[model samples]
Target chain A: MPYVNVKVAGNLTEDQKRKIVEGITELLQDVAGKPPESTYVVIDEVNRENWGKGGKLLSDKEK
Target chain B: MPYVNVKVAGNLTEDQKRKIVEGITELLQDVAGKPPESTYVVIDEVNRENWGKGGKLLSDKEK
Candidate 1:
């Protein structure tokens, strides 16, 4: 079983999450010969305050 | 930067999640030479109904 976890920088809509779960499942099945039913995809939405890049929190970065 | 996403079969307590995050951060630093400050650990708690194993959903398995 392949469990794929995706970390996104911000929140996503339900539709977006659904598409991700579906797309990743299909990709794993196509590339790795895994079954869609056995594949698991979880998306973790991270707030900018908790995410850092280049030693700086994303929240503090210039927009 | 190393981003680690942990997928668990069930929910975890905040303390357990914290330990996991800290342990994984240290492991990445030790093995990959990644900085703890740049390491991000996101734990995804999957419901039994969503997690499938052996072609069967965990929720349907016999307890």
Candidate 2:
């Protein structure tokens, strides 16, 4: 089983989540011959305050 | 940089999130010699309907 984890700095609509899940599943299946039904896509809606990049939190970077 | 994703069936409190991040960072550093500063820990709270096990949705399993 292929486990895919996607992290986003903010929220996503249900439609967006659906599209992302579908897209990732298709990509893995096409590129690596993974089974779509067996692939697991876990999306994380991370708070900007908790996400760090370039030694700074995303929230700080936005300021 | 090492990226770690943790998937949970339910939500977590802010304190719990903090501990998980800290614990994972420490584990990676001590076990794999990864740098805590550059390591990324992301936690995803997945809905029962979206998570599947044994070809059945987790929501259905609970019913």
Candidate 3:
């Protein structure tokens, strides 16, 4: 079984989160050969200030 | 620098979760050369019935 984790910006709507989790679970179950029961998915959201990319904070860089 | 994902069972104490996240972050940073801001972690919990391994549910297999 495979465990799946997702990291995204903190502003996702509940619907988005739900769809993403379910999608990932299915993907892992089929692609990774993980059992449905053995698959776990976690989502972590971070503030723009806390996330950085390309040498700048995501919030700052995006603006 | 890196997006770190941890796949773990449910029912971890907050302390265990924190330690695991921090440890994974450090490992990714050191091993993958990812910046601190680029690291993210998520935890997911599932019922044993939903998780299977070795042709059996983890909860059932363990029991």
Q: State the lDDT of candidate 1 residue by residue for B15-47, as single tens digits.
A: 566567667777777898898888776556789
Clashing pairs in 1: none
**Which pairs clash in the backbone of model 2?**
none
DockQ of 2: 0.12
lDDT of 1 at B59: 92
Residue range A1-63, candidate 2, lDDT tens digits? 888767899887766766777788788778999887788767678899999999999999889
Candidate 2: misplaced stretches above 4 Å?
A: B1-45, B48-63
Better of 1 and 3 by lDDT: 1
lDDT of 2 by residue, B1-63 (tens): 999878887689999999999999999899999999999888878886555443344555587
Looking at candidate 3 chain A, the ten consecutive residues that score lowest on lDDT are A25-34
RMSD of 1: 8.2
lDDT of 1: 0.76
Q: What is the C-alpha lDDT profile of model 3 across B1-63, one tens digit per residue? A: 335464644455677667656655654445334466666666665676787666888788777
Give, for candidate 1 chain B, the lowest lDDT window spanning 10 residues: B13-22
What is the TM-score of each predicted model, taking all chains together? Answer: 0.54, 0.55, 0.50
When sorted by DockQ, best at the front, the candidate numbers are 3, 2, 1
